[model samples]
Target: MKKLSMIAAMLSLLVSTGSQAMGPFEVYEQALRNDPVFLGALKERDAGQENRAIGRAGLLPRISYNYNQGRNDSKATYLNERGNLHEDRHYTSSGSTLMLQQPLIDYEAYANYRKGVAQALFADETFRGKSQELLVRVLTYYTQALFAQDQIEIAQASKKAYEEQFQQNEQLFRQGEGTRTDILEAESRFELATAEEIEARNEQDAALRELGALIGVPSVAVSELAPLAQAFQSFPLEPANFDTWHALALANNPILASQRQALEVARYEVERNRAGHLPKLNAYASVRKSESDSGNTYNQRYDTNTIGLEVNVPLFAGGGVSASVRQASANLEQAEYELDGKTRETLIELRRQFSACLSGVSKLRAYQKALNSAEALVVSTKQSILGGERVNLDALNAEQQLYSTRRDLAQARYDYLMAWTKLHYYAGTLRETDLARVDEAFVRR
Candidate 1:
């Protein structure tokens, strides 16, 4: 009763003083702005944003200029018209033309533009998925730290109790009222408790460091969670029909949606390759001025302007176009199979996590009952020892059992929360707002 009262008082002080403790959502918000892993994905998403512009550029106008310069020399000899004549010609020749062309119809570029749109959407969805995943990771590490803190407290409490018992046994033995075996047994248990306390402190430190790394900060202090009783009193909502979760996974999962976009890109690839067999046409205009000296005649200078349409008809390629088409077709087929595979895999994961959450409530309930029983046994054993009907070992065992149940209960709650997060992820509905829902379960402290 005294230990329980002390724990309650400590909890009250912790709640009152830990106003600045970082909760899961608080850490998640920091990660959104600063976490290197998720920030890297944002940069990648930015890079991918240019896909549409690049695809659309192929359909825009292009303008260019060309220049040429040279010297010409010739010698001629004839026997009939005029007695053998010989001539030589040399001159600097240079000309420049500015040309402009516009593509009127480009099926390949059109298909590629559509593909670019899909790819951009895929990037956005991928980033959203990464953000949601970070939330769960933050929550997981936060809970672990809380559990570690509880373990340290339990270990310390047990160690204190054992030290008192050992001192009492030693005094009684010194007075010749206690057996030597009783003193030795009490001292051994005390040593074991000391070791346990050391281990629990180490675990607590490690958990704090892990949590700090997760939120991009050094380990300092974190807010204690709401009382476990309050946080886990109610079970999570369960799916009415398992098939409903499977359907939701297929339709809403962000990864699966990204894969669907990839499939769209592959289908467009087929269209782009098939376009190679179609005619290509461009309208062009240019103007140029040039001067040249012909050895057989006189020097001449002229300026000219021209405008025309250029057309290219693919009569044949050494089967290269056909090969490209086949490759694209194969890729499209591969993407289809990949999407199908992901759908099944996603459904399986959804069911697994869903089932865990469903059964976790029952497990939590059982542990709650077990903890009550353990506490009662600890109390009864102490009473029996006072009446000379039980040994110190019996009370120690009951105390240890109670602490074990507390740790298991804490772990089960963490698992329940994890499943809740995963179910939302598979359903493509996880978001920052969802973190608020989780926060409601944990009172600010």
Candidate 2:
């Protein structure tokens, strides 16, 4: 009863504290702005959006201009009716040519444009997947820190209880009312609890460091979890059956969607390479102007404009086109295999999380019952010690059991919450709204 009152008082103090605490969703928001991995994905998506423009360029008209200006000196020898005539000329010559070409028929360019569309889609889906991953990662760190904090609390409580027992046992022994074995046992347990408290504090520091790295901070204090009764209220909205989750994953998983786009890209690559066997056709126009030529025509100026159609039929390219086609086909095969493997792996992961969530609920209930039983045992053992039916060592062990049960209950709570989040992540349904829902389970400060 006294421990319960103490816990209630601590909760009240936390609720009334003025200092702010970071919630998981807030951490996620910070990570969105600061996480290098997610920022890189955003850049990659922006880069992918240019693929359409790059591929379409092959189908567009192209224009080029060339100009040259130089002084030329030449001497020419001519033999006509006379024996020989020598001519010398020096002139400044300048010329410019402008040309334009438009593709009349280009199967490879068409395939490339389609491939670009697929690539852009792939990038979008990849970014979406990264976004979900960041949310999952932030929450994971938050839960780890929470669990570590719980461990520290449990260790401290156990240490304090053992210290009190040791002092009482030492005084009793000094007064010839307690055995030396009881005093030694109490002292030993107290030292072990102190060591455990130190280790728990270290684990908490490491967990906080990990969370800080994600959000680009040196350290952070996370908000306490909402009361268990309140946190559990969110679970009823989860899907009931495994089939529903599996279907959702198949339909919506961003990774799988990205891989499908990759497969389309590989298919178009094969088409682009295969089109190399086909003839190419282009329409071209050119304007040319020249001021001077060699010695004979040194004083002449001319301008010309022309339009024409060009055709190139591939006879052979030393088997380069065929090799490229073969390579693209091999790549397409690899993409197919990868998508198949990823689908299976995704389903497997989904199943694992689904199972964990279900089992976690049951485990939470079991641990809660165990905690109640352990608390009762502690009270009973202490009462028995007063009546001389139980020794001091039994009371110490009961206290340890109660603290251990508290730790287990705390861990189960975190595990249940994390498993629920993970299940949604694997289903590709995690979103900021999901984070909002998770935020309901945490105090703001």
Candidate 3:
């Protein structure tokens, strides 16, 4: 009973320890929330929002207060028989006023605000694009780490088989049933397997370290990834016509969206420049107060109030306004051309990703069949050897073939998963929810 209890305790400890290890999707989630690049993109989006606010402010009313106080030494003048006389005197004057200006009809302000709105939308899309890009990178590294782990397992298994063969050959040589050449061959194979195992282990370790750094947890240990399973079964493979994909790419791609916004901004810039040739009108009002000690006046204090309208007509500006309008128009044209180019490029990429996804799925199916055949062959060879058939190099060759097939199958599965992810991402359908599903698949239960 005590032995059983100890075994149970050990099993429980292993489970507890293994639960601490994170999987690929969990790592991606943690990186999304903590990674520096994502955080920087978020900050940039916020800055763009602030810029929108600043632009909007241009169309709003502005109010200001002004105050002035001064003391002056002067002479009083009287319109009399002697014309004017100077007298030693000093006077203090003070005034305060309030002014308000509203953009009653500013075309430039309207265009600028419109541009700001477009820019803000573009920034939001850019942030989303950054998030998608980060997720792709995380998936790539995670799959690479899994591939390395599989390679290590394969190498270790091969090494163990070679070691067993070596021991068997040693026993046969002792009995004078096997030649020294067989023993030496087994030893050489065993040494090669050991070297391969070491190389595989080192590669896995490096991959782990790289993933850890990417996820902002440099100490994390990635134990294992979930077997690629039914998650990829429902991936759509219908080859979308070029026109259909082109339309989707134009509408959904972040780069295309950003270019479209840039074009809008450039168009608005032209409008803003053109508005510079229009007249600007404003209204102003002020009140003033003064005090004198040596003037023939009814009171020592006086006040004045005035109100008026002002107009500024842009008659000429050394052709600067025309040059600005021309430059803005040129930029607008360039932006339009860029938008077209980006749309075409994105459509091409979508087609390429779609093709890759289809090919990967096909490859996965073929590899799955190959893996079954390899396993069968390994079992058959083992049975033949056990049935008194002399185990020759054919047995070793069959084992090696089985190992290669299994590794290739694993690689095919990962490739299919990656290709599926790429398809969804390009389709703009890879969302946080999809990531959450991936997380659920990898979670230790």
lDDT of 3 by residue, 86-110 (tens): 6666666555666666666678888
Candidate 2: Cα lDDT at 134: 92
**In each prediction, how many residue pairs overlap at the backbone (N, C-alpha, C within less than 3 A)?**
1, 0, 0
Better of 1 and 2 by TM-score: 2
Write model 1 residue lDDT over 144-204, tens digit each, in one string: 6777677667767777877787788888789987777877776787677677768866776
Poorly placed runs, candidate 2 (over 4 Å): 1-19, 175-184, 222-234, 293-297
Each prediction's TM-score versus the true structure = 0.80, 0.88, 0.77
Q: How accurate locally, in lDDT, is each candidate?
A: 0.75, 0.83, 0.71
Candidate 2, poorest ten consecutive residues by summed lDDT: 225-234
Clashes of 1: 1
TM-score of 1: 0.80
RMSD of each: 7.8, 7.2, 7.5
Reference-based lDDT, residue 110, model 1: 84
Please write out the lDDT profile of model 2 over residues 1-445, one tens digit for every residue: 7466445544533553346565777677767766778889999999998898888889999999999988997887889987888877778988899999999998998999899999999989999999999998888878787777778778888878888998999899999999999988988887887888788778778777776666555565544333233235236636789999999999999999999999999999999999999999999999999888545457788899999999989999999999999999999999999999999999999998899888887787888789889999999999998998999989988998998888888887878778788888889999899888877787653
Candidate numbers sorted by lDDT from highest down? 2, 1, 3
- Scanning candidate 1 in windows of ten residues, the lowest lDDT window is 222-231
